[model samples]
Target chain A: MVNTVDPSGPKPRRALSARNIMLYGTLMVVSMYYLLPLYVMVVTSLKGMPEIRLGNVFSPPLEITTAAWTKAWSEACTGINCDGLSRGFWNSVQILIPSVILSIGVASVNGYALSHWKFKGSETFFTILIIGAFIPYQTMLYPIVILLREIGLMGSLWGLVLVHTVFGMPILTLLFRNYFASIPEELFKAARVDGARFWGIYFQIMLPMALPIFVVAIILQVTGIWNDFLFGVIYTKPETYPMTVQLNNIVNSVQGIKEYNVNMAATLLTGLVPLVIYFASGKLFVRGIAAGAVKG
Target chain B: MTSQSTAKRPVQLLRNLSAKIASIPMILTALVVFVGGTAWTVVHSFTSSRLLPKLNFVGFDQYERLWSTRRWLISIENLAIYGICSLILTLLIGFTLAALLDRKIRFEGAFRTIFLYPFALSFVVTGLAWQWILNPDFGVQGVVRGMGWESFAFDPLNNSEIVIFGILIAGIWQGSGLIMCIMLAGLRGIDEDIWKAARVDGIGTVKTYVRIIIPMMRPVFITALVLIASGIIKIYDLVVAQTNGGPGISSEVPAKYVIEYMFRAQNLGQGFAASTMMLVSVIVILVPWAYLEFGGRKRG
Candidate 1:
């Protein structure tokens, strides 16, 4: 099997050798496993209710229709609102924008300071922050609820935004800290020697130089906050529920007639934002998650 | 030293005032939230807080009740099952996929994107999609049955005994790609000479991977293991979306248990205890990883 196709050649491997067949065979089957669900979703979302009732989930639609998509977008009932997933879409967008901005804003600055400015006990605080990332969010949920209630921001989008900022701080700060620390210290010193203050060096020198890391941070936060369910459910009201929460309610609610097509459409719509970000950004998305995973 | 200390002590707080000011959020979060909040919860767990968090000092009764409760027991059992299976399977599948791609295969990028696109979607989407695909009437069971095997029985979601595996299927689909990507990075980090050396020694690919590549990739495996383990303990949304602890609480997870008690059950004490358990579990997962990862460097 090792050299059946190319025994006399310099390289013994062949394109269609038994080994290649097994390798590509396993990958092909696994890829089918990955691709099958998405295909079922698209096909289901296109078929009508009557057609889907035929009980063939894997089959393509007899005739494609966008009714389910529109209804999912504008008319589906999710917790008595019947306003479809648009409200959640907007809610997620509102939550996503502010959460991303505030979290990244605080985190980038925090990262820059931790890496460059060695204040007294800074390492102590930084160490605490890193450990903070490991603490289960369940343990801290009520305390944050109390804190938000104290601040009069409980059950509001801003409270959720603040939660995202706090939670995202650890990973984002680590990402930027490592990235900024890699930059030659001479650049920071030169900027300092040129009569630059903290904000000056940060805004003028660091921000522009850290564009790639910023993109990485954005890719990380966008999918994370967008796909978030627990926080959105915990922190926001039904009216202000993010897409994931609304999506769950819309699909899992026990009170309504189950619309499989609409549910598929709703799930697809809920997934589109992050999916677009994932595909469009490609390798950067991998870098973002890897950074989040292999903590420094 | 005393004179220098005295000279700089007065201006110490003022030094890097701007940087300190910039760090206010991190400080407050680290101190007031992470440390303070966790401590507050731990304290509250000792009290019999119901409806609202009041300091009643119940002396472990909440924990006693929690351990005895069937729901919490099932939740923990499910988490353990899910965690262990997920850890091993994720590593195996992730490494296999990584190795296949590392074989200089054609369309690696396309294959990876196909495999990982699910990770970008929310757990709700993954769950619902799998839920539909696992539907008894229209899903795999049905499709296979229609193919002429009338006695086929693959319905796991509605079955109490195998419900957790149903959720496990969805969880793996949504997660293993991350481990694959990480493993691929580790694989690429290996020197080309290692592969060349193995080839010159007339070693087979499987032997090289088993005896050589895997042992050398301990750090990467540990990273993946730690990531998967911690995530398994936090499993909530996927369960909620997929099973919602359905078929009579068979698929409940600890995270879901924590949320239900705190918010819906209005049993704050139980919630605190359960969440504290989650924290302990996370620490249990992290401590060893930390020791393996940084113990030598930190201590020696």
Candidate 2:
């Protein structure tokens, strides 16, 4: 198996090796397992209702149609509103953009402070924040609801954004703090020598150097805020439901016929944002997850 | 020293005023939301709060009712089965796949991307996909039955006894890829010289991994364990999306129960008690581990 006879020559043929065969075969099988669900979703979404009812979900559609996609986007009913997932899509976008910016903004600043400017009791707060990440969100759900209601932000889009920011702070702050800590202390000292203040050095020096981390943070937040069902469902009004919540309502609602095609289509639509981010930012997505998984 | 520090305190506070100001959100969140909110819930759990929370003490009546409720008990059982199985299977499959991928296999990138793409999508999407795939009429069972095996019963979603396993399948499919990625990183971090040393010592690759590499990767495994354990405790969306605790609430999980009681059933006291139990369970797992991981480090 160690083909070291001629170092510069082409490797000897091991195509039929048992180890190679087993490795590739297992990989292919597992790949098929992972690919199967997405394949079913795409095929089911593209097929007509009649084809779906024909009860062979694995087969490619005989007459492929984008009607389900259109219906899912524009006209499928979630409940009383027949406007499909478009409303939820826009609502998600509204939640995603602001929440992403606000959460990342506060987190980056907090990370910069914790990493560079070590005030008294800062590490205590940082430790608490990190541990808070492990506390189940359910324990704080009602209190947050009450807090948001008192502040007149409950059942509002901005309220949902605030919730996302709060939950997102722990992990995002951890990511940025770790990233910032990896920078040479001499550089921060030099910046301080130039009389740069807290926000100034952060915005001018660290921000530019941490572009990759920022991208990773954005990818993390975008997928997180987009795919959030619990917060969106709990915090927002019915009209302002995010895509995942709306998709669930549309699929699981008992008031109408079970249009599997449209349901799958809506599912795909809700998943599309994160799927695109995952594919486009492939290695960075891995890095983001690694960073998020660091505390764990 | 105390007098000198006290004299410098105001000056120190004013030195990095902006940084101190910036950290206010994090401090407030840690103190107010995580600490204060959790304390509030635990305290309120002792009261008879209904749709609206009040201070009327009930002396563990909520907890008593919660324990006696069949739904809550079923939720606990489902979570236990789901959590234990998910932990074991995810680590096993993830480690196996990572080991295979570490063998300089071709198309490693493509295989990893395929396995991990599911993790990118939400549990809602994963749940819906698996729900369709497990649908008795047109899914795996149906396909198998259509191939001249009429008596093949594979509908875990509908069956009361095995519904949690149905959700487990989706859970593993969505999560194991992440564990694999982490494990692969751990494997990559191992020195190639260790493999050469093993080869020179006439050790089998399987023995090398089990006896040597796995022990070396204990921290990585711990990280993955904590990740999976947290995810297991919060297994709500997948259940809701897949079966919605259906077929007579056979698949209810603690997180789902907490949410359903808190919001839908308008039972605030019951919800708080259930959520407090969840907090207790997490602390039970977290405290000793945190002590070992961080506490020893400080002392040493």
Candidate 3:
């Protein structure tokens, strides 16, 4: 982003010069490629079914309609349930709030301990935990199912919340671990020298200073748990399916008429939360994901 | 090992008790779920554990059955094709976009926001959008035909032969931006002096990139490769939302096969074997990278 000058480069010229044209031209084409689906989804969602069948997905609607949006929000059915995606939306909210809070709370504490406390064999456990992140969730899914069944939380939203917390721990812990480790060791020593124990330092000093990373972790988990289809489908019954799972079922269910307009509307609705988070917390979202690429 | 492991002292055991108490969730997750669970599955895969994972050791039967199944083979082939193509194209496209945006051009932020927005959407949303776009009647093919390109066929989603590629198109759109952001960070990390020296040598921009910049950014490339490779092995929701492994199960992948057998078909042993194979593929991809990244380093 820094405009470091290249002394040997072409002279500064008008905006419509040959080089500028080529550069902007390529960028514009690529931009369109990225934006086209969103454009199509919105355009298709706004048109009625008959008009959509006329076969111009790129055109603006002649007569716009809000019927598809309402239908997708309330009237579209999945199986015996004729109620639309609002149920799934609320279910996701139920899953999202607790999962995000519990995961970040546990992970932030774990990160603080690993960086500052350094107990026996802590690194071994930490290494195993980090390596666990790369393990395919399919391998671990059944065992966790059995774990949930034993506790009688199977097919419940809280069970899915626990599942999200355990799976999310590795990355969130690492995100906070690498962050807390970079803090000067002197800060911890100073706090300890003042006779402050673990809880006092963590609650007073670490919590306030760690606000930004908390935002990043929240963004990561909110978008992740909301967009999760696998855990939602596997852990919860139809009554508690998350938005993504229900969206897929509604759009892909074989029994229904293929209502493309309603399907697009539902798809857009499913995607709205994450898209909003990504746009609103633009650079922090980038930082959160980029943290994954950073090695221990 | 810390002093407590060797000393076995009571004080060391009680030292930082709150920290250790807090780490119980983490320790249980690492030891019980990740390690113990994987071992349990691998062990059970050898048993005749059907319908409810009741173990009655039947060594290699599940493996034999899995290898001989037609669906499993197609899934492997589909994964191999998808993985290779996705890797090459993502790195190429990701790096190229990074390079373009690094040009200090106008509206770089706007360009990046556009390119990366799809990464924010779930695969379910992405798949359905593309599914509608690839609809044979009212989608790109129809639009193209209506625009006078008669006889032009482009319906990959419904066609069993190329359904995977149809999924691949949606996959790249949703994922490449993350790699782009990573590669841009790597490009930024390169000293500006490198570019100055390349320009001084009169080397072209593309040449300088291939010969100098890319080779220098090997670590970043590896990180991105590992991220993409791990992501590629778990391509379930996208396929489910897109084709549902349709056209007579021609588009099925290993994850879907595992899910189908274990959850739906009541064949736990088969799903166990299929999932174990997935775990193996992931380990094969991960171990070498972990060694290269962390094995040699010493903890302070």
| Retained true contacts (fraction), each candidate | 0.76, 0.72, 0.67
Ranking by DockQ: 1, 2, 3
Judging by DockQ against the true structure, name the best candidate. Answer: 1
lDDT of 2 at B255: 95
The model with the greater DockQ, 1 or 3, is 1
Instruction: Please report the candidate that would top lDDT against the real structure.
Output: 1
Model 1 bad stretches (over 4 Å): A4-13, B1-15
Q: Model 1, A1-296: lDDT tens per residue?
A: 46523233256446888878998999999999999989999999999999999859999899999999999999999766988999999999999999999999999999999888867777788888889988989999999999999999999999999999999999998888888888898999898788787889999999999999999999999999999999999999999999999999999989968999999999999999999999999999999989988541
In candidate 2, which residue ranges exceed 4 Å CA deviation? A1-13, A294-296, B1-13
Off by over 4 Å in 3: A1-14, A293-296, B1-15
| DockQ, model 3, C-alpha based | 0.58
lDDT by residue (tens digit), candidate 2, A32-135: 99999999999999999888888677988898899999999999997689988999999999999999999999999999888888787888888889889999
Report the lDDT tens digits of candidate 2 across residue range B177-231: 9999999999999998798777767777889999999999998898888889988
Tens digits of per-residue lDDT, candidate 1, B1-300, equal 011244555334454798899999999999999999999999999999989999989899999999999999999999889988998999999999999999888899999999899989889899999999999989999999999999999998999999999999999999999999999999999998897778778787789999999999999998888888878888899999998998899999999999999999999999999999899888888898888888868631
Full candidate order by lDDT, most accurate first: 1, 2, 3
